[model samples]
Target: MKQDEMIKLGISIGDLNGIGSEIVLKTFDDSRMLDFCTPIIFANTKILNFLKKQYKLSLHFQGIDHPSNAIDGKVNVVNVWKENVNINFGEEDTKIGEYAFRSLEAATAALKKDEIDVLVTAPINKATIQSDKFKFPGHTDYLARELGGESLMFMITDNLKVGLLTDHVALKDIASVITPDLIEKKIRTIQETLKKDFRIRKPKIAVLGINPHSGDNGLIGKEDEEVLKPTIKKLRDKGDLVFGPYAADSFFGTKNYKNFDAVIASYHDQGLVPFKTLSFGRGVNFTAGLSKVRTSPDHGTAFEIAGKNEANLNSFKEAVFKGIEIYKAREEYKELTENPLKKQGKKI
Candidate 1:
């Protein structure tokens, strides 16, 4: 296959002290994955080679100076940095954290320039990744700034899809942040993501309440009645298929989420807790509403089992597949919109 014909998958090696490298190697160890996309890992080949020996894997990486030099059907590595970085698995070293940021920075620059097609990022240690150059809570915030979009943390699996209204925010600040404007923006972002990225023509979305029992008619709190209820009602009045402010306590316990295309949660824990519970090993965290497609494993850097050769590669592999799918879906959506007459003829 030609390089242009293959989807160029740019990967950022997350915290080296974590399971990022392990999962990346295990996923691509299958030669069949090369048939789908040409992966360019943004890290030094020497370091990866060291890990290759430690894990005793049989994958070979072709080193390249730039992503454009990537060869199809080959695992490629961009030398984002030179020299050796000591790798002590299960330990958080600030030096390793800097190298993690370096890998991500290079890959994101390639994404912005269209040097690569889609990006599947490995998990990063949120606390360790904090520095003067990288001050965001996580990848989503940094990507939002660099890629230019109102991003939504959309956690997805085959059977369930959840979007967070407020992600990476403190528990106490969630209520104040759940304003009418914030709720509306997030819901619209989810709707656009469903339509363009997921190919849902008319998506039905459900919103979980802020307070228990949707504020118990203003007894528990007035945010649900004053903020959520009005905002969701406004969106519905405009012919959007959005429902809820459903009582959070029973929304998922009753399987009410099955009725909608996606569920929008009021806060991080409210959405992710149920999401991770239902689909721990299978979920993909997709950053929706961005110009470029990006995804990551829903789970984090499991320091406990970093180099034990016991990390499950399912979520990381799923993330790679999901990124490619969304990239193709977006391209198809763009093509159909460019020729409205062709799109109209298909319906007839």
Candidate 2:
């Protein structure tokens, strides 16, 4: 990938019954999208048409047989399904789920074959997609499995960025899985991604503790003192700017999150509660440590306002923009790595 070359993006249409089609249609309406990268959406044309008619959008979608038939200034949609089916918005159907899964699988296959530069997925319903054929947790797990299952969930906002040590797990089971090795692995993965994908030369990561008041020095729980502290010390001794065992509650309250480049939460809610509060409809979910770039909007399917056309495309728009940014950044990093003198004494 060259800096001057155009990046091609393979987009997977999320749940068709949800607001996925709406956001995809709305996002392509913006003319500025053409300036960033060439987008190829893997979805049913019938569903896209339904949303366009429902929303009364003026944008036109050009259905193509393959990625090579795509044209500029027009939304290129590849029909992954052979048959055109009726889509009922705000209602869940197994056929729609299967179609969504197929679209994602097609996009993933294209991505694996180097046909596209990055993948920007729309949201999908987890339960609906967990049938006999597609038995994965969500996009993160599904993509991880497809891409050799080596990845971590990295959620981002302009103000705060949090990476989970354990995601998509039950609350009670989280404590048992919060081992020192797992914490170290997640931290290292995030650190590497910050450098490679984000173009941060030296990323400073802040690790959140597992207990209240950071275990109050073993008063509340020993996990903080016994597990988290040693891991942070180890990472620091390795010349990594990793600190904490910081109490999760006060860490975000005192605006302490602003000090570091990224935050590592011990469990799911410990990080997402504050993260969602600050960036519910504005954040971008990035899967770090994949061979190829992958990103999605932070928000999920807004079933309540599904057909009302009140869904906000801001997060989806940001996800696309961030995907482009990461792809470009990764290209630059690769270039810099190839030619170290190009970045010498240059302000990063």
Which prediction has the highest lDDT against the true structure?
Answer: 1
Query: Candidate 1: global Cα-lDDT?
Result: 0.93
Tell me the spans in candidate 2 whose CA falls farther than 4 Å from its real position.
Answer: 345-348
Q: Candidate 2 clash total?
A: 1
lDDT of 1 by residue, 225-338 (tens): 999889989999999999988997888899999999999998999999999999998999999989999999989889999999999999999999999999988988887888
Tens digits of per-residue lDDT, candidate 2, 88-148, equal 7788787778888898999999888888888999989887776776887789888887886
How high is each candidate's TM-score? 0.98, 0.95
- Per-model clash counts, in order, read 0, 1
Error of 1 at 173 (Å): 0.7
Query: Which candidate number maximizes TM-score?
Result: 1
